[model samples]
Target: MAAIASSGVKPITGMLRRGLILDLSIALGLGFTFGSAFWYGYHMPRTNARDNFYKKLEEQRAAKAGN
Candidate 1:
């Protein structure tokens, strides 16, 4: 049955093409997310405010021990 075979072939080919497109799109999205995270972390700014806070905590601990 040539007609039946042709009909089956069409749906199979369409599904395979759609699957490939979906896979490629998902891969691109993941790549973008990872790339942005890496870029921001690598270029993060330096701040001394956090360092000062930790230093204050250490000072408090030392004072408590002396008491």
Candidate 2:
């Protein structure tokens, strides 16, 4: 009984499959969109780069003083 069940579940010949090229193309497009968003956020001058740096520096100074 077990052998018969295992044989039924085995992969049949010519049943192998490969990813469609179209699916890969769609994934590449989504990656490009997310990458662009990250690039824009990191490099945009209007973003709070200076404020964030000063905030982190203050934290470090406070930590050093506490220790």
Candidate 3:
């Protein structure tokens, strides 16, 4: 009886450890995905050749305000 209890406990402990590792992997993956998206968005090239619609609107507003 004591041997059976100890044997059952090993599998449960191993499964719990694997679950924690899987959780860490998933969290890191999500964090990296979000972090890369933010880096890409923040690092986009700034050029007048590109038609930035919202930027144009803000510029027009500023021009109007100055006038």
Candidate 4:
């Protein structure tokens, strides 16, 4: 009985095989979006240029204090 049941069981296939292309396309788009967002937020000049901004501000403050 067990052998007959095992023989009757077919391989699992074809449930979600239709939309593979669409799935891959969405994955690629989201991957690029998240990657660029990470790069901009952490590695872009605006984020790293904050030190320069503070230095300029301190310079202006010192000039005003000296005046």
- All candidates' TM-scores? 0.47, 0.36, 0.47, 0.41
lDDT of 2 at 39: 75
Q: Which candidate is the best by lDDT?
A: 4
Clashing pairs in 4: none
Better of 1 and 4 by lDDT: 4
Clashes of each: 0, 0, 0, 0
Q: Which residue pairs come into collision in candidate 3?
A: none
Which lDDT tens digits does candidate 2 get at residues 1-67? 7788778576565544334566777899999998888878675644678778888999999999995
Per the 3 Å backbone cut-off, how many clashing residue pairs does candidate 2 have? 0
For candidate 4, write residues 1-67 as lDDT tens digits.
7787689678657746757777988999999999998898777877669888998999999999995
- Candidate 1 residue spans exceeding 4 A from truth: 2-10, 43-67
lDDT of 1 at 2: 75
lDDT of each: 0.78, 0.77, 0.77, 0.84
Kindly report which residue stretches of model 2 are placed more than 4 angstroms away from their true locations once superposed: 1-19, 43-48, 51-67
* Poorly placed runs, candidate 4 (over 4 Å): 1-18, 45-47, 50-67
Note the residue pairs that clash in candidate 1: none
**TM-score (C-alpha) between model 2 and the true structure:** 0.36
lDDT: the better of candidates 2 and 3: 3
lDDT of 1 by residue, 1-67 (tens): 7788767445555787899999999999999988878766653432355677888999999999995
Q: What TM value does model 3 have? A: 0.47
What local lDDT score does residue 46 receive in model 1, on the 0 to 100 scale? 28
